[model samples]
Target: MTAQATTSEPAASEPARRKTAIPKNPGRRDLGLRATLLFPNREIVERYYVPVIYTACRTCYSEQDPDEIFRRALAGDFDSLKMQKLIGSVIESGHGSTIEHVVFTFAISGVSRTLSHQLVRHRAGVAFDQQSQRYVKFKGAATMLPHSIAEGDPDLRTRYEEQVDGALGLYGDMLQAGVPGEDARFIFPNATRTNLVMTANLRALIHMSGLRLCTMAQWEIRRLFQLIRHEIFSVSPFLGSFLAPKCVPLGYCDEFNNRDGHCPIRPHKDRVLEAWAEKAAAARAAGRELPVT
Candidate 1:
């Protein structure tokens, strides 16, 4: 029997072997370069957020109030470089709402359903639309073979294929057997991945990117964000530049697990606080005062 044919298993069965494979031509199977910016086109960006957000940062310091600032910014009364500098500083200071006014929509294609499931967990500041398993019968559905499976033991990898194929086989059988698609879908594994389209405002995109960009985020999701970041950079490098790991903005790592400081992204927030406290104590002992932000 064909290795593919022999490797099938029931939905409840575990893999016959423990090996996982990384695809030989990984790039061929890669969810390569997914996510296309669909709306709020470049014209909209040059006409709107670039100026609007710039105005938001400048208004506070300028003698002119926000209305006047916005008018002048849109009217090209100020240099983009000066405006960007102020926006950069204000954003760094945690003024997030000013950047929230602009949004980006991406046509995210070729991601696994697995990635999409974890992605939608983010409730605030984002939106999503996925390829519906119910609406789409998936006559020619595709599946992802994880890198682990690709690079595993041959025997173990064979077993893994069998399990995935068997699950897909049962799904097809159930569909042909008149079982409802929803119920038949119980056989689908987390690996039975799918695709989606997602959208977010600059605030949300940056926020989500921050969380998922962390080392703690799942690898697949991290890779996906890297692609998303690339897409943003293609259009407006200025806006795209904001998408980054959360620690980049925080100036230090805050994750509790980093107490040992292994992640190395930044000094732990606790450690920094403790150092500040120690300095304060020393100052008090010396009859001096610690300056506060």
Candidate 2:
């Protein structure tokens, strides 16, 4: 009898292999997205935001009470540059609690439900109030057309649009047929538009921006963060500067998908470690220990 053949197929419970290629940087395009800074305009941010964070940082080292430190900061008792420098250093040092004392509220609109789902996943130090599909039945509901599909083959684009429109038309028909709005909304696609009011502390904002600004992020969410960064910059460039890709501050890209170094914002961690190893090896060969920082 012939021996039974062996197979290398993956087990049924095993997860599918994920794509490794980092997505292309979706350069800013008009998606009709808007991110408006609703609270703490320029004057409020300038007058209070910095001082609030500064007081949090200074209170750590100073014997002075936080209220007194905040008062001094507000009264211009500390040199503006010096205060900013200290705040920057503390933030760089990963003393995140200091920055958590301040928060920014934004009115985000015209973003896809897909993006909103990702956005709400950030829960720490962030609060979100989103438009409800169940409570507010959408009339002539708007949907987002992804840049790729919008610019793809003419026939493909029409097909995509027609499918989405058909679903929306069915949703309306279901509603008219006495179906609950919640049930009708089951037909809505991820491309459906959503609005949210998000208020996040500086620490959470920085962390979220770091992730969503990365090239590996979905294009719609990346574009949302871009608009968010722009809004923050309009009020405070110093604060906005902190909202960058995680790799920018980490000094090395740690994304597993970026092993090919496709995103050029920074070198991959593996390469950085490899270079360090090589330097240490050369030092050892030369009968000298590599100095550690």
* Index of the highest-TM-score prediction: 2
TM-score of each: 0.80, 0.91
Candidate models: Cα lDDT each: 0.75, 0.88
Please provide, for model 1 over 9-123, each residue's C-alpha lDDT reduced to its tens digit, 9 standing for 90 to 100.
3356655554332112222234432677887777778777788898777666778888887888899988888888888877788888888877888887656668888899988
lDDT of 2 at 260: 90
lDDT of 2 by residue, 124-237 (tens): 999999999999888788888876676679898788888898999998899999999989999999888889999999999999999999998988789889999999999999
Model 1 TM-score relative to the real fold = 0.80
**Superposed Cα deviation of residue 269, candidate 1 (Å):** 2.1
Tell me each candidate's RMSD, in Å, in order: 8.7, 12.1
The Cα error of candidate 2 at residue 272, in Å, is: 0.3
